[model samples]
Target: MAERILIVDDAAFMRMMVKDILTKNGYEIAGEAENGQQAVDMYQEQKPDLVTLDITMPEKDGIQALKEIKGKDPEANIIMCSAMGQQAMVVDAIQAGAKDFIVKPFQADRVIEAIQKALS
Candidate 1:
């Protein structure tokens, strides 16, 4: 079965872009959130197989959301997304239990690769 994925980004366009790519590649879009707080809520409701999370967002940011999710479910699969130059945050995300990360202005292959690696 296709993996169910939740996408969390404050920008609707970003979420749409990711949804387009993942759907085209046969992944199921389980849900979407415009902020970290919403992401956490949706996660509990959906329990998706994976989540693509933006590091910068209003109402809590991705790192905080990641922490909340990981705290709730240690095995939660998440891939952090950020623009270039957020290395420190990326490292912090990894330390916080994110399985992998993808840079913004996303490349489809890169996103897929990260998700696959995280799932594996």
Candidate 2:
């Protein structure tokens, strides 16, 4: 069965780009969220196999949302996304429990690889 995935991003375009990649590769899209809070809420509802969270967002950032989700379900598979290529933020995200990281202007291959690796 395709793994259900929750996509969280403040930008609709980013979310659409990711959804297109994952669905085309046969992964199931559980839902989409526009902010960290929504991501947490949808997480409870969908209990997706994985989630791709944006590190920077309005309302709540990915780090906060990742913490909340991880707090609720330590096993949640989450991949962090960011447009800025900052090593500090990436390290912080990894320390906070992100299974993987994907840079913005995402390459379909990298996105697929990250998701697949995270699920594994």
Q: What TM-score would every model get versus the actual structure?
A: 0.98, 0.97
Instruction: Please tell me which predicted candidate would have the highest TM-score against the true structure.
Output: 1
lDDT of 1 at 106: 94
Global lDDT of each candidate: 0.97, 0.94
Residue pairs in clash, model 1: none
Model 1 Cα lDDT, one tens digit per residue, 9-90: 9999999999999999999999999999999999999999999999999999999999999999999999999999999999
lDDT of 2 at 69: 97
39-111 per-residue lDDT for model 2 (tens digits): 9999999999999999998888999999999999999999999986667888898999999999999999999
Worst 10 residues of 1 by lDDT: 111-120
Score candidate 2 by TM-score against the native.
0.97
RMSD of 2: 0.8
